[model samples]
Target chain A: MSPFVLDDRLERDSEFVTALGLCQLRLLKDSRWPWLMLVPQRAGKTEIFELTPLDQAMLTFEANLVAGALKQVTGAKKINVGALGNIVSQLHVHVVARHEGDPNWPGPIWGFGTAVPYDNDRKHAFLTALNEAIGS
Target chain B: MSPFVLDDRLERDSEFVTALGLCQLRLLKDSRWPWLMLVPQRAGKTEIFELTPLDQAMLTFEANLVAGALKQVTGAKKINVGALGNIVSQLHVHVVARHEGDPNWPGPIWGFGTAVPYDNDRKHAFLTALNEAIGS
Candidate 1:
């Protein structure tokens, strides 16, 4: 099998945080929401079913672990998880930490507005805490 | 433990299709997109991580099954899966079959536009075919 390649759009918009059992964890650049994405290291796969059963199970576990970690680190009221490949056609799961009155409250944050890239200090601190939270 | 109760908003917006091993499958009323929701029959749970490990694994299996069935029945170019309990904290997973150049191409369907309820005949036909595709 060919080595997995991150989608250009995802690469441009997010920073690598760590690697999970079956996915490469990345923190989205947007500062408006506490968001992390899990991209399974599988080439040419665009949907969850495209993964083998073992990989699928691992994806679930990793997603759960990341979501819980995100919630814990951010103290978010809710965590929104999604795998939408319409624009990028590469399988990546988004785990966003949402508060009651975040920028896009009670709504999915996929296409809300211009992404406010995180400043360097905030990004560093966020990634450090997240790494500690996920133990990665 | 209390019996599972469908959230009022979800109940108003979707029709019961069938019960999978771990979720109550329902078809969204919107005709714009072929959307199905898999709501785990576990009351008061608003997140996948809140579920037991076994239930979480079952959710992954059922979601894959429904997404595949929806894709087969709709011939959708892509299938988007999400579990966002922002508005209705019912812990339901959305399995939407998306096609290229559809109404909201490259954008999420959530909170995009008002839903157009499926007419009686079309709804019946869709439910029949979906049931057959899911082998329920």
Candidate 2:
């Protein structure tokens, strides 16, 4: 495990999934879509450039792993993966599965409509399947 | 070097800057912003999972290297990086340096405005500095 701390914004917003090599994968609380976030457990690292080359590589692996599983498990039409630090500024990679008619179909998902927080039972089932898919 | 080929869409749209591991870094001919695209030269590969683990790691290193250089050379306020395969599903990574009031502030830069292509002299100068910055 890394000597890193989770950002308060992420902790408060997301439900913890599991940890990968250099990232802690979290499920965004939004029930509108299947979205997973990989937060690198590197302290004070807001940008990808701030990470060591090795950590960067490991991050890529973990990002791909999570994205692949998310796509397969959800049967999404498309998968969008990005690391945008405009608002949170904490180095978090978002892996979102997109469908043809999802709320924000053709545009970037940031600053979109309100997030529908997941209910307890649904969140449990979804996370359980996701954990198995990601082999966590 | 791997036997990778550039996609036709990228070749027609972008100006070749240099080659990094797992990608060919190109300047998205738009002069309005300092935008660069890293297209993984792996032929016919559209997803990150298609890449070998080592190549994925190498791609991460290259993306960070280019992003770091771009941030320094442009003195940007923040850098936006993502692998959005919406239009062209050829697995290209975008590394854009964003300023506070650069046309689209506090938002994603995709499809914001018309792209103003760079002129020969300006492109040459910019790429020259970029080459040194990224150690190409």
Give the alpha-carbon lDDT of every model: 0.92, 0.83
Which candidate ranks first by DockQ, i.e. highest? 1
In model 1 chain B, which range of ten residues has the least summed lDDT? B102-111
On residues A13-125, what C-alpha lDDT tens digit does candidate 2 reach at each position?
A: 88788878888888998988888899998888878989887788788888898888888888876778888787788799989888778877767677688899888898888
Two-chain complex of model 2, DockQ on C-alpha atoms against the true structure = 0.64
Candidates, DockQ: 0.92, 0.64
TM-score of 2: 0.90
TM-score of each: 0.97, 0.90
Query: Retained native contacts per candidate, as fractions?
Result: 0.94, 0.57
Candidate 1 segments exceeding 4 Å error: none
B17-51 per-residue lDDT for model 2 (tens digits)? 88776788999978878999998878767678778
Give chain B TM-scores in order. Answer: 0.96, 0.91
Question: What CA RMSD would you report for each candidate?
Answer: 1.0, 2.6
